[model samples]
Target: MKINAFADVSLRALLVLSSAPAGELLTTQNIADAVGTPYHHVSKAIVRLRELGLIDVERGRKGGSRLSQAGHKATVGQLLRELDTRSDPAECHSSHGDCPLIIECGLRGALARAREAFYRELDGVVVSSLPSFRQMAPVFQTIGLRPGM
Candidate 1:
């Protein structure tokens, strides 16, 4: 049940954005640095997040990104489901060829149910509440923002 790297980076970007002061917009590089991820990966995550309405981005010299109203209220399950773009929980086709069981396998159904259950367990978990401001302040400070800023 491992999520993909893109989904992981998107979550990390959200966590960093959620820690910022209200209305504060953070540059993609700043977020990348804060999360210890590469700038390009964070940039791609930011674009997808904005497309999904989870974050807002402005384009200009002073422009950056911030959590949208939707972002603040987003559940971990919701975002993960959206970010994890796999059509099937398991791939029936491999380099060897399609599985003979693909036509009649009950495993796919079971796996789908299991994946949904995993998401349901996280439905009550809000992304913004993952780490408190105090917990994130030190990381933000390393990126040049003040503790409460």
Candidate 2:
């Protein structure tokens, strides 16, 4: 049930962009710094997010990134599904063909159900739901993205 760093950074970047000043473009390096991720990692996440239509990027001297309309409405689960590469809840390690319980064991099904339940819970949470404008203002300020700028 552990989400990878890519998924975590994707959410953080989206949240950061969602809270940024209107029409203000944010650099990926700035975002990476803010989220404590590597430059290349954030860059890759940005590309993936754009490919998913959850974010928009502008190139050139004034190049930067921002959350798109889809991003604004995206649920936590939706983003995770898009960014998380892990498909199976549990790995089948019966390559040796020695395990007899592999075929009948309920562990895999149980894990899948558990993963579904986790996603279901996350579906109720919007990326922008928990951190209020009031809560985000100070954070934005710290990042030099002051309110009303």
Candidate 3:
């Protein structure tokens, strides 16, 4: 149940948006630089998050991104579901018939349970509960935000 690098950046992008003062729209490059993630990955996450209705993006000279209302109240688990972008267990075990143990293995079931438990644990956490970025003073400056934003 490991989060992929894309998902990791997505979560951080949300956290960066969540850190903003209300109504602040942030550029994806700012988030990428602030989180130390590649711009490509961060841009992809931003687009997906926008499509999922968790964030909003507007184009134009003064345009940028901002967390939507749902984003503000998003649970870690919910965001993970949107960003996970992977299957549980393995494709070989589920439908490919690529594994000899597919017929009798309990591994898939166990993995499913473990993944559910992991999400259950994460569900209790709200996005706002993530640590404040205020601790990273240098990043705030680079992101064009004031400290404690």
Write down the lDDT that model 1 would get. Answer: 0.89
Candidate 1: list runs displaced more than 4 Å. Answer: 147-149
Off by over 4 Å in 3: 91-97
lDDT against true structure, model 3 = 0.80
Clashes of each: 0, 0, 0
Best by lDDT: 1
TM match of model 2 to true structure: 0.85
TM-score of 3: 0.89
Report the lDDT tens digits of candidate 3 across residue range 1-149.
68788778888888888877678778888889989988998999999999889898999888899989888888888878767756655654345457886786788788778877888899989886685655556667887786445
RMSD of 1: 1.4
- The C-alpha RMSD of each candidate to the native structure, in angstroms, is 1.4, 2.6, 2.3
RMSD of 3: 2.3
Residue by residue across 52-93, what tens digits does model 1's lDDT show? 999999989999999999998999999989988787788886
Please tell me which model should have the higher TM-score, number 1 or number 2.
Answer: 1
Assess each prediction's global lDDT (C-alpha) against the native.
Answer: 0.89, 0.79, 0.80
Better TM-score candidate (2, 3): 3
lDDT of 2 by residue, 14-70 (tens): 888887778888999878876778989999889998999988899999999987888
